[model samples]
Target chain A: NAGVTQTPKFRVLKTGQSMTLLCAQDMNHEYMYWYRQDPGMGLRLIHYSVGEGTTAKGEVPDGYNVSRLKKQNFLLGLESAAPSQTSVYFCASRTPRTSGKNTGELFFGEGSRLTVL
Target chain B: EDQVTQSPEALRLQEGESSSLNCSYTVSGLRGLFWYRQDPGKGPEFLFTLYSAGEEKEKERLKATLTKKESFLHITAPKPEDSATYLCAVITSSTLGRLYFGRGTQLTVWP
Candidate 1:
C-alpha cells in the first residue's frame, strides 16, 4: 500500500512564482500534516488537517496555505514563493491517539525538494 | 516554552560498532516521545515510541528507552545501511497534535 505519497518529488521555481504540492495517503488516517526540513532544523510543521475540509496553521505557515478537499488528499499551495521558501517538504498521516489527537506515530512521504531561485 | 534537543549532531561508526543517540526535552504534560530515521532525500520513518519513564522498545539493531526528561536510541552493531539521521520528537499536550522535534543526530556507519 502506498502509505503516504507526495507529488513533484523535485521542482525549481523562480522567485514570486506559485506552485502546489500534493499529498495522498491510503491509511485512512484522521490527521494529515505538511512539514519542511532544512539543514540543522528538524521538520517544522507548515500546515495540518484534522479531517476533510479542515485545516489549521502550524509553526511555519506564513508562506503557505493548505486545503483538504478530500479525506485522502491534502494540498499545499504557495501563492507567491520566495527564495527563503526553498526546502524539502514532507507529508505525514497518522491515526488519532486515545485523546483524539495525533500522538507522534506518523507515516511520511518521501519528500518534495523545492528550490526557489 | 517547549524545547527538544538532540546531542552529537553527527556520528560516524564502523560496522559492528555500537553507540547511542540522545534526545532531551522540556515540556509540560508529557504525552509521548517518538523516534524516526531519515535517509538522505527521504522522509522520516517511524522507529519507536516511548510513553513514560523506564519504557523500552527494541527493533532489529535499534532500541529506544525513555525517561522523564530524555530518551535514548541505542544502535547495536551498526551497518552502512543503518546510517541515517535520527530524529526525536515529543507530544507534549493532549489538546494539540503538534509534535516538537529536535535537530536530529546524523549518523554515518562506514562498512
Candidate 2:
C-alpha cells in the first residue's frame, strides 16, 4: 500500500508566487503534519491537523497555511513564496493514540522539493 | 525550554568501524523517543522507538538504547550502505501528537 504520497515532487516559483503541496495518506491515520527541512536544520513542523476539519499552528507556521478537508488528505499552501521558503517539504501521518498500540511513529511522504527564486 | 539535541554534527568511519550517535533531550515529560534514518533526497525512514528508560531495540547493524535524559544509536560493524543522516525526535507529555526533532547526525561510511 502507498502509505504516504506527496504531490508536485518538484517545483520552482518566483518570489511572491503562490503554490500548494498536497499530501495523501492511505493508512487511515487520524493525524497529519507538514514540515520543512533545510540544510543543517532539523525538520520543523509547519502545521498539523488532528483530524478532518481541524488544523493547528506548529513551531514554524508563518508564511504557510494548511487545510485538512478530508481525513486522508492534508494540503499546505504558501500564499507568497519567498527565498527563505525554498526548502524540502515533508508530510507525515500518524495513527491516533487510541489505536491501542504504541502509535507514536509517523509515516512520511518522499517529500516535495520547492525552490523560490 | 524543551528541546532535542544530537551530536557530533557529522562523522566519517571506515567500513566495519563501529560508532554511536547521541541524542539528548530535556522536556517536561517524555512520552516516546524515535530514531529515523534519512538518505540523500529522500524522506526520513522510521528506525526504532523507545518508550521508557533502560529500553533497547536492535535491527540489522543498528542498536538503539534509551535512558532518562538521552538515547544512543549504536552501529555495529557498519557497511557503506549504512551511511545516512540519523535523526532523533521526542514526544513530550505536553505535545502528544507533535514530535520535536534534533538537528541530526550525518554519518558517512567509506569502504
Candidate 3:
C-alpha cells in the first residue's frame, strides 16, 4: 500500500519561475498538509486541506498556493520561485480530528527537493 | 507564543550505548505530544504520541516518556540502523490539526 507519494522528487528553478509539486495518498485520509524543511529549522507548514475542495493557510504560506481538487491528491504551487523557497518539501496525511483522542499520527511522503536559483 | 525546544542538536554513540534526547515545550494548553524519526532526505516518520504527564510508550528499542513540561526519547542499546533525526511536536488546544515542531536532535549510532 503506497501510503503517501510525491512527484518531481527533485527540481531546479530559476528565479521568477513557477512550478507545482503533486502529492497523492491511498489511505483515504481526510487531512493533508504541505511542509518545508530547512537547515536548522524544523518542518514548517505551508498549507493544508481538511478535505476535498477545502484549503487553508498554515504557518509559512507566503509565496505558495495549494489545491485539493480530489480527496486523494494535494497540489502545492509556487507562483514565482525565490531563493528563500529552496527547501525540501514534504506531504503528510492524517485521520480526521475527533474530540480529544485518536493519536494524530501523520503518514509522510518522501520529500521533494526544490532548488530556486 | 507556543514553542518547542530540543537539546543536543547532534549526538554520537557507539553500539550498545544508551542515551536520551530531550524535548521541552511551553504552550497555553497542551493536547498531545508527538515524536518522529527522520532519515536524511526523507520525511518525518511517526514514533510515539503522549497525551498527558507520566505517559510512556515503547517501540522496539526506543522508549518515549512525557511530563508536564517536556518529553524524553530514550534509546537503549542502539544500533547503526537507529541513526536518524528525532523530532518533537506539540498540538495545542487552540489548533485542532496544527503541530508545532522543534529543531530536532540528530543521532548517529556507530557499530
Candidate 4:
C-alpha cells in the first residue's frame, strides 16, 4: 500500500500566485501534518489536522491554510506565495493507536519542492 | 516554549569508523523522543523512539539513548549507504501529536 503520497512533486510559481499542495495517506491515520524544510532551518510545522474536519495552527502558519475534508486527504493552500515560502514541503501521518502511546514515529510523504520567483 | 537543537551540523567518517550525533531539547513535559534519517530530496525515515529518560533502543548499526535534557544517536561501523541527515524530534504530552524538530546532523561515510 502507498503509505503517503504528495501531489506536484515540483513546482515553480511567480510571486503573489496561489497554489495548493495535496497529501493523501492510505493508512487511515487520524493525524496528519504539514511541514516545510529550509536550508539550515530544519523542518518547521505549518499546520496539522487531528482528523477529518479539524485543523490547527503550527509554528509557521501565517501564509498557509489547510483543509482536511476527507479522512484520506489533507491539503495546504498558499493564498499569496512569497519567496520566503519557497521550500520543500513534507506531509506525515500516524495511526491514532501509535500516536496515543506517544510514539511519534511518523509515515512521511516523499516531499514537494516549491520554488517561488 | 519548546526547543530542540542538534550539534556538529555535519560529520564525515570512513567505512569502518563509528560516530555519534547529539540532540538536546527542552519542553514542558516529555512524551517521546524520535529519531529519523533523511536522504537528499526525500522525506525523513523513522529510526527509533525513546519514551523516557534512561531508555535506549537499538537497530542494526544504530542505537538511540534518551535522557532528561538530551538524546544521543550512536552509529556502529558505518557505510556509504548510511550517509544521510539525522533528525531528532520531541513530542510533548500536552500536544495531540505535533513534533518539534531539531536542525539535524548531516553525516557522510566514505568507502
Candidate 5:
C-alpha cells in the first residue's frame, strides 16, 4: 500500500513564479501537515489540516498556502516563490487519538525538493 | 513558545561504539516525546514515542529514554547502517497535537 506520496519530486522555479506540490495518502488519516526542511533550521511546519475542508497556518506560513479539500489529499501552494523558499518539503499524516488508541506518530512522504532562483 | 533542542549537532563513531544523543525541550503540558531517523534524501521515519517521564523503549540496538525535561537516544554497538540524522519532536497540550521538531543530531557510524 502506498502510505504517503508526493508529486513533483524535484522542481525549480524562478523568483515570483508559482507552483503547487501535491500529497496523497492512503492511510485515511485525519491529520495532514506540510513542513519544510532547511540545513540548520530543521523541519518547520508550514501548514496543516485536521480534517477535510480545514486548514491552519504554521510556524513558517509566510509564503505558502495549503488546502485539504479531500480526505486523502493535501496541497501546498507557493503563490510567489522566492529564493528564501528553496528547501525540501515533506508531507505527513497521522491517525487521530481516540479512546481505542492514543498514539501520536506521523508517517511521512518521500519529500519534494524545490529550488527557487 | 514551545522549543526542542538537540545537542552535538554531529557525531562520528567506530562500529560497535556505544553513544547517546540528547533532546531537551521547554514546553507546557507536554503530551508526548518522539524520535525519528532520517536518511539523506528521504523523509523522517518514526522510531519511538514516550508518553511520560521515566518511560523507556527499545528496538534492536537503539533505546530511548524520557525524562521530565529531556530525552536520550542511546545506540549500543552501532553499525555503519545506523548513520543518519536523528530528529526529536514533541507534542504539547496547547498545540492541538501538532508536533514541534528540533534541529536534529547527525550521527555517522564508521566501519
Candidate 6:
C-alpha cells in the first residue's frame, strides 16, 4: 500500500539552485496536489493537476512549477531555490469527486523536507 | 473571500482529559469540510469529512460535529497517542479539488 511516495526525503540546496520533487501514487487517482507546510501557515497549495496533462496554480505558486505528464506521477520544480522556500512539501492524491463514496478524501505522502541556504 | 480558522493555537491536556477543538469557516458554497491529524515531520492524514450542517461522525475516541458555520472535534479521554496537530480544511464552489486550510491546533496529551 504505497499510497503516495515522494523522492529525496531530505534535501539541501544553495541559493539559485534548481531541483525537482517527484511524487508517485499507485492508487490510480486522477487528482494530484502539491502543498508546502510552514509554521503557522498550515498547508498552502502550490500546484495541482486534474488529470494526466492538466495543471493549475494554487494559492502559493510564485516560486514553484508543476507538471503531470502521466497519471501516476506529478513533479514539482523550483527553478531558483531561495531561503524563503525552505519548507516541508507534501504530495497528495485522491479520486475524482464523481461518486458519493469517494469524494474529497486525500491520501498524502510522508513528506519531503527541503532546506535552502 | 473563503477562509478557515482554528481556535486555540495550542492545547495541553493530561491523559484521560477530554476537550474539543474548533474549526470555523466562511466560504461561498461549502462542498466539504475535512479534518486531518499531522505529526512532526509527517504529512497530514485524513480523519473525517463533513458534508453539511448537523452531520456527526465518530471514530474511536474522537467525535466530529458540524454546523453551518463551524465544526467541532470532540476528543474523549485523550491518550498520549492522540497528541498531534489537528488541521481543518474546506472545499468550496470555487475550488474543486483544492483545499483551503486553517493554521491548525497543536494538541499535547501528557501521560
| Estimated TM-score for each candidate | 0.95, 0.97, 0.96, 0.97, 0.98, 0.97
Q: For residues A1-117, could you state the per-residue lDDT of candidate 4 as single tens digits?
A: 999999999999999999999999998899999999999999999999999999999999999999999999999999999999999999999875554586687999999999999
Indicate whether candidate 2 or candidate 3 has the larger TM-score. Answer: 2
- Against the true structure, candidate 2 reaches a TM-score of 0.97
lDDT of each: 0.91, 0.93, 0.93, 0.93, 0.94, 0.93
- Which 10 consecutive residues of model 1 chain B have the lowest summed lDDT? B91-100
TM-score of chain B for predicted candidate 1: 0.96
Per-candidate total of colliding backbone pairs: 0, 0, 0, 0, 0, 0
Candidate 4 docks at the CAPRI level of high
RMSD of each: 1.6, 1.1, 1.3, 1.1, 1.0, 1.1
Superposition TM-score, candidate 4 onto the true structure = 0.97
The CAPRI category of model 6 is medium
Question: Candidate 4 overall Cα lDDT vs. reference?
Answer: 0.93
Off by over 4 Å in 6: none
How well is each residue in A1-117 modelled by candidate 6, as lDDT tens digits?
A: 789999989999999999999999999999999999988999999999999999999999998999999999999999999999999999999986755633667889999999999
Cα TM-score of candidate 6: 0.97
Query: Each model's DockQ?
Result: 0.70, 0.72, 0.70, 0.85, 0.74, 0.72
lDDT score for residue A27 of model 2: 88
Q: Which candidate is the best by lDDT?
A: 5
**C-alpha lDDT (0 to 100) for residue A20 of candidate 1:** 99
* Model 1 per-residue lDDT tens digits across residues A1-117: 989999999999999999999999998998999999999888998999999999998889998999999999999999999999999999999987857444688989999999999
TM-score of candidate 4's chain B against its reference? 0.95
Candidate with maximal DockQ: 4
Regions of model 5 farther than 4 Å from truth: A98-102
